[model samples]
Target chain A: EADIYQTPRYLVIGTGKKITLECSQTMGHDKMYWYQQDPGMELHLIHYSYGVNSTEKGDLSSESTVSRIRTEHFPLTLESARPSHTSQYLCASSEGQGRNTEAFFGQGTRLTVV
Target chain B: QQPVQSPQAVILREGEDAVINCSSSKALYSVHWYRQKHGEAPVFLMILLKGGEQKGHEKISASFNEKKQQSSLYLTASQLSYSGTYFCGTEMRGGGSQGNLIFGKGTKLSVKP
Candidate 1:
């Protein structure tokens, strides 16, 4: 389908549990981002990767960490999940720069922390 | 930096037109638009670069003004399908490889048939 995919469409976990949300792109994009969005609220960038071995924290300081070992895979991990971390995680990827470079988003992973 | 979107929420009737504006204090390289339905992921609408050009996706068109550091999305002949939250994402030059796109609070649009 030439799109981005996020695994575990929905997750419900206990507090202090380690978890990882997987995101993969089949479009071979170089840029990938992880955004945290609460229901009907604004989206906050948590983490992003430019390319392989390149990752950076986003505008929103997050307790979660991300890795970009491959061009297509960008996964977000939390050492200890908390109720504060409960939110929808969205994954997006872009090809290049400028107006032509539009980002494609995945369906998103809705996580509920208890 | 995050852009600011005006008219946080709007209600329109079918066939009516609505304009949602996005403004940023910082200069922008490009502005991207997306529409997200309730309980669904956002869908890309269009991208307007700094050149002050206009782009349209489906019935939605957007314009970017470099001088004003703002972008406006026009929804002409609104339909029930147009009911969703509209978000404007701004991308500035030289922010590392991610080119991170910062989004505004978004404008929620409700279209009634």
Candidate 2:
């Protein structure tokens, strides 16, 4: 199994609450990503980091932000959560070097904003 | 770029064969295939690196056409375990792009025994 892990496998928070979803990988992967997926829907890339101090917005415009302070950890935070943010958040990591390596995904965090 | 998947869903009987197709407008450097069951994170099935590359995992295999910017996943002798949503993630280019992968909407497959 992949060493990646997402904390709060499930979260339910009220609107306006600040929340952070934790993602960590022991694989020492340089590339990390956050994807939002609705049930039975496509996985939308929201944020990604090539390495420490490097973060980029994904194809989807999301209200959440992420930081890559350590190679093993990338966390997504929302200043003020909303009901619209209720969905599954998946974290993935892959080896870098422009190798196009396969991504390893965590179990994912199911967030429900009430 | 986000890839497009055809036949939003498909139904198959045990032992039947099925194919799911994915296409992208942007040039593809690599194609990644994944399968996800209900309320679960997607599992990496396979990846095709080179153009016109074909790889197999058990009864499941995939083919990539670089010039056409398309990839197709084939499932032979499907089993109940094959029931899930299949997604195709496309990497930016052959040279790679920060190792980011854009995915297709996904194709839901149901195998009935």
Candidate 3:
């Protein structure tokens, strides 16, 4: 099993609520990513980080923000959540920019905004 | 560019054979294959480098054609455990996009007894 972990496997909250999805990895990888996936759909990259204090937006436009002050933790925060933000958030970590490197994913957090 | 996957889905019986194809419009650095079951994270199957090499894991095999910018995954004598959504992630050959995978919509495979 991968050493990555995501807290609150499942979450439910009201609209306009602020929430943070926590992701941590013990693999000591430098590349980490956040992907949003709807049930039974393709995975969409939302955010990623190269290393500490480095973050970038992905192909998908998301209202959520992330910070990587530490090497092992990358947490995504939604200042004001909405029903449209309800989806599965997956955290993945990879070692480098090598052409053959594979990413390890966490269990994922299922968020529901009512 | 996002690679396009063919046959969006396929259903097979145990011991049957199936193939999933992925093609990209842009030059590829490599190809990554992953399988994800419902309510779970995706599992890496294998990676096909730009050299157009073929890799196999148990009964699953994949071939990449760099010149053609295409890849094909072969599943021989499929097992029930192989049932899941198969996704092909493409790494385009260019600047600013390294290590980040642009994934296909995915192809759902179902294996029945």
Instruction: Give interface RMSD, per candidate.
Output: 1.1, 0.9, 1.1
lDDT of 1 by residue, B3-74 (tens): 999899999999999999999888788899989998888888998886666465766777788888989999
- Cα-based lDDT at residue A92, candidate 2: 98
Badly placed stretches (over 4 Å) of model 2 are B51-56, B94-98
Lowest summed lDDT over 10 consecutive residues: which window, candidate 2 chain B? B50-59
State how far residue A59 of model 1 sits from its true place (Å).
Answer: 0.8
Docking quality (DockQ) of candidate 3: 0.75
Give lDDT tens digits, candidate 1, residues A1-114: 448999989999999999999999988898899999999999898888778998999899999999999999999999999999999999999985432577888999999999
Report how large a share of the reference interface contacts model 1 reproduces. 0.74
Off by over 4 Å in 1: A97-100, B53-58, B95-98
Clashing pairs in 3: none
Clashing residue pairs, candidate 1? Answer: none
* DockQ, all models: 0.78, 0.84, 0.75
What C-alpha lDDT, on a 0 to 100 scale, does residue A80 get in candidate 1? 100
The TM-scores, chain A only, for the candidates as listed are: 0.95, 0.98, 0.97
Residue A78 error for model 3, in Å? 0.6
Error of 3 at B102 (Å): 1.8
Q: State the C-alpha RMSD over the true interface residues for candidate 1, after superposing those residues.
A: 1.1
DockQ agreement of candidate 2 with the native complex: 0.84
Global lDDT of each candidate:
0.88, 0.90, 0.90
